[model samples]
Target: MLAALAAGCPGGDQRSISGKVTYDFVPATYSATTGTGTLAFAQASKRPVRNAVVQLRQGSGVIATTNTDEQGNYRLVYIPEDDSGELSVQVLAKTSSPQIQVEDNTDGNAIWAMGAKLSGTDAESESGTTLSLHAGHGWTGSAYDATRRVAAPFAVLDSMYTAAKAFMAVRPVSFPALKVNWSPDNVPQGGDKASGFISTSHFSPAENEIYILGKAGADTDEFDSHVIVHEWGHYFENNLSRSDSPGGPHGRGDVLDPRIAFGEGYGNAIAAILLPESLYVDTVWSGSGGSLTAFGIDAETEPLDTDDPTPGVFSEASVHRLLYDLYDSGTNESSYDKVSVGLGPFYDALAGLQKTTPSMTTIASFITALKEQPGVDSAAVNTLLSRYNIGPITSIWGEGDSRMFPMYFSVGSYPYNGTLTLDGGYEYNTWYQNQYYVFVGNGSRVTASVNSTYDVALTLYQQGDVLGGSDKTTSGTESVSLTTQNNAIYVLVVTGFKETDGGYGISISITSP
Candidate 1:
């Protein structure tokens, strides 16, 4: 009997099944094979099924197994691992093929034909593509088709779009209807490209695009989600400040400005809050190597240096640490700081306004209202704080710490005595800890001529309550006079310095006209 069964089986001793799957009337593409084909089965009841497991079973032993593709077609291969003789096939949740016997005949054609006839009921209509996406209100451009040849089941694109729309709805401006394209090539290795980004022109509005890697939900990652949201955050900030200073005096562009730190931080925070499950998977997945902490940061131990620069707002490491602290096991003082304290109220105001107003239109209005109230820099902080609402942020520095420290200034001296010539210099002091400075005035256009008698050293910190100075040096007498176009303030401070002399000093002078 076993020999007879083997003789009747298709592919003879080799056991394999091939067919196509479809869901909701759409053909499902196989991950291993990119081909699409129609399922030809004699049975009509077993055509469309969901979550049905398809497998090749030999006797009681199950061989290779795979679930039906979303479109109800599945292919199963019988590997050498399973005994090849009498085979049993089954269809799930349907009465059609409770069990079917296939003989592994010496000539495999019969078994192959027997296996090929397994079919399912068709549950979906063979309808044409009628899906349409609208570019809601405040969208500047007309809709454009963004279809491309790529892997299917790109659900991440949908998630990114939903998040972006939600975020924009809360803002006070109209977001443009941007076309999105998904491609493995365009998908960034470091972050998701769906988050919106602005064109390079300093004043140009942001361009809208979303990119996704076609993969199963299990294969999709979290960085892409976070990055896409972060880009939207930039859009909110830029649109809010359209008429304000281009980049602010710091020279950092809209995205990099220190004033926008709150915005960046908020973006990350919102990403965390909304996608907590995704966050858990990314952080806790054993595939991630067990180093990911609850806050989605690497917690592996590493060496540290005393002189390393403190992480800035843009530092991924620093931002991760701060976020970890904020979202850690329990709340602490940092949670109630100015930035943290104001975030909740600000968010509440924006939410309330969003009910009656469109986001793009009302974002600026809501932000303006929040700024005019109290303790907020309406021109800068309100827009950012309201969106992410981390609460009040503690002042960046301590009390009595000079917010602005002077680094160099150009002024003529009867005797120019300073080792630091037209170039810049540094100063250090124990009292200057937590102190930052503003270097005011232009140094390049000093007008004073060479002189020996009158000596002058550029003052480091002069205006604020904090009194700090760099060591004096008498290198040569050169009357350096700098012409002032307009008084410009350059701020600096020892982010980190040794306490040896309480402070070290290097000579620097700003020449005056």
Candidate 2:
């Protein structure tokens, strides 16, 4: 039973009305493990509903209007001094505009206000009043229609709205609106089959779509606020920030490609910051009356912080924990984490520096961006950086990195010769072996070769686009020859026949007849 409040004004003095908006929520179809049979809505629960517009009115005319913030609170001020004190508070019928309901392709019932009530006060005295709004719920027979009608999609929208508002708060800009497709079979065809909630959501820039899981039991994701925000975070990176991430399967403690590590870690870290809660949980369960599993971002269970034994610069877990350590006031009690800079600095780094970094978007580039911010103490920044076994903050190229393997050490100016060890850890994200970059002049034909006792292969690439490769046998040398068109840079990769490891010599020279 939520209502709007109308305060009284005396002697032409100004008056105000303020209140919070909350909704009676029912978890239509939620699973902690696997979603089975017919999905049923959970019991009614209450939570704040944000971004609804509220108005203070007299008779048929409006005095002032304001919209709720992320917390679902709003205030209307400067009402004319009404001697009669007769007034009413109203919640606008439409909570969102046409442009905002991109996901609801059918009917766009983006949101609905259940019902509204009004309160009146005696004339002549100036005082303030408060009230709340109770939102309504309805459903259509179609599964897709029902999803858009329920709290899951609304919750996802709310979380994304909260994140978008956070970015605009720091620097105002027009945020791109997109659709979120939530259904049991929302994932791509031939994609991994989900048990309950697909556990992952992906953004397709080409289609401008985000498909979420609405599968009852097997895998649905509407109720997982962090997962929603995390997916939205990816959308932001793809839209606003530069994502050079080689997209693939990744998770905690994985030695990912640096690009993938930063991109995924940024998403995970920001989700925690947006919620700012003590725990980041992803619950899984079976069908109705089934057992439940709660995967909390608890240090003891998912110890991703500095204490992680396999702390690699390439670890997504390390990247996520590092970003969280930088943005949150919470501490793991092992280091100087009290220097939490919160979301302002983190957002600044993401939207400002990381978005346009010259190098591949990696943790090194991210740290470089953080250090360049005015008034940021490099020492304090390094203190947190060092905790993850990364030695120090030097160049954005990640030079002098004693912890991470020397994977990207350049081949220097070409006509170049260098010796590299193709050790077992040289594999990047389970695909590439060891890749190194070199420069070549336009119209130049170059011979790139690798010599080693172990069976090795050689590949040539220009800015990640493979030019050519040569893999002859499993116990000798390999080489490839290509002519450059423009003044282009190239990358030389060394890999074993079977991802083996050993000493290798690489050479590149301008071809001469």
Candidate 3:
């Protein structure tokens, strides 16, 4: 339910004062059991007495009113309504002295301090509205200015709340809290020069705040709403993973693999799904004047080549293009003619996989699986292969390994784990013929144990070489040296044929030392 709005002032006139109504710092004592409350305002002896009229208005229309008691206290009924929209309370002071200005003092400890009370509702509704004040310590004036700035835009704040509520209904996963503030000091500025920031997007489970930049009567830009919503999406993704790692990079073999690309892609996807209208269709590859054929490979320059084995950049534009193609292809929806049409088949396939293999439900999971496989790098190529389940292993082992290309190889004696070394590391098996090789050390020295149980086998082959080797091994090292044939292309394999049940770790180092 929305908050209640005060009644309109009497008289149907052509002109009206439109603004938000805050009881200021006035304190009110109300009973939780009963929906009744009292507002108390202090009176100054030097100031002349006056009759104060307080009325609640929803938009330009008034709803209720009451006069202040002799003690400057007022009692009113609480009517719950859609006052979530912009509303204000107008105060009119009637004084006997013509020249004396009656100080309402409503902005002081009167309304702002006590806050508004809730009546005609349950305990939840009884809690008063709370506006947080965040001013850097030792700067009370700046703090007050910030508070006042946001205070002036209560109407806009209310509207934002309503909009948020609506947005949540469609995207329950995006459970964002509301935050209100006086200015943009808390938000980050563009290109490096900016001041304080206030965000309605909280990374934690707390409510978000909206800030009004102490500037009086200034309206927030429409883009601000979009930015806040996008931030909320980050929060949603964070919570969904239940781990902070999902929002950042992860380590892999002495390298920091960035997860931001995938994370941002998902965020953008969520944004598109939630607020399709908010995005400029023209900016998207699927939109007007854009086509999947132009994705990554510029149609004007590179031209589309379905047979191109190499992958290209998987930028946001490219990813969006793929998604758009899937959506348009009817793969997302069901239809015969549309089968394999656009990117729809791909998206639908991924969604289906997520249901059965929940681990693959997230983009991160898909990336992790791809990274673990051997030799699959380019983002665009990974996405393409992952879509068809023809990943690193499958790409090599399946379908005759059509994509297989030898990269490098090794064959020689080398120190094993900085300890025992081996010599005469040569194999006469058929597996050695025509196979790629990646050598680690020169074939000059031998320091490994002579016992057959401490021997190691090495082999090299292209993607289709998944089947020739025996799955038995123990202790040993294998290395092969190859010249730069076809740009450093060759494949090398090392195996320890030791008669032991325990597992051994092998280190592969490249370069001559």
Alpha-carbon lDDT of model 3 = 0.29
The top-ranked prediction according to lDDT is 2
Between prediction 1 and prediction 3, which has the larger TM-score?
1
Q: Write the per-residue lDDT of candidate 2 for residues 139-236, one digit (tens) a residue.
A: 33322344234355556656666667766676665667656655444432344332222345666666666656654434555666666777778887
Global lDDT of model 1: 0.30
TM-scores, in order shown?
0.33, 0.65, 0.31
Q: What is the lDDT of residue 52 in candidate 2?
A: 58
Query: In model 1, what lDDT does residue 97 have?
Result: 21
Which candidate comes out best when scored by TM-score?
A: 2
Q: Over 4 Å off in model 1, which ranges? A: 1-160, 167-169, 176-182, 187-223, 235-267, 273-295, 298-509
Better of 2 and 3 by TM-score: 2
In model 3, the Cα lDDT at residue 141 comes to 28
lDDT (C-alpha) at residue 287 in model 2 = 46
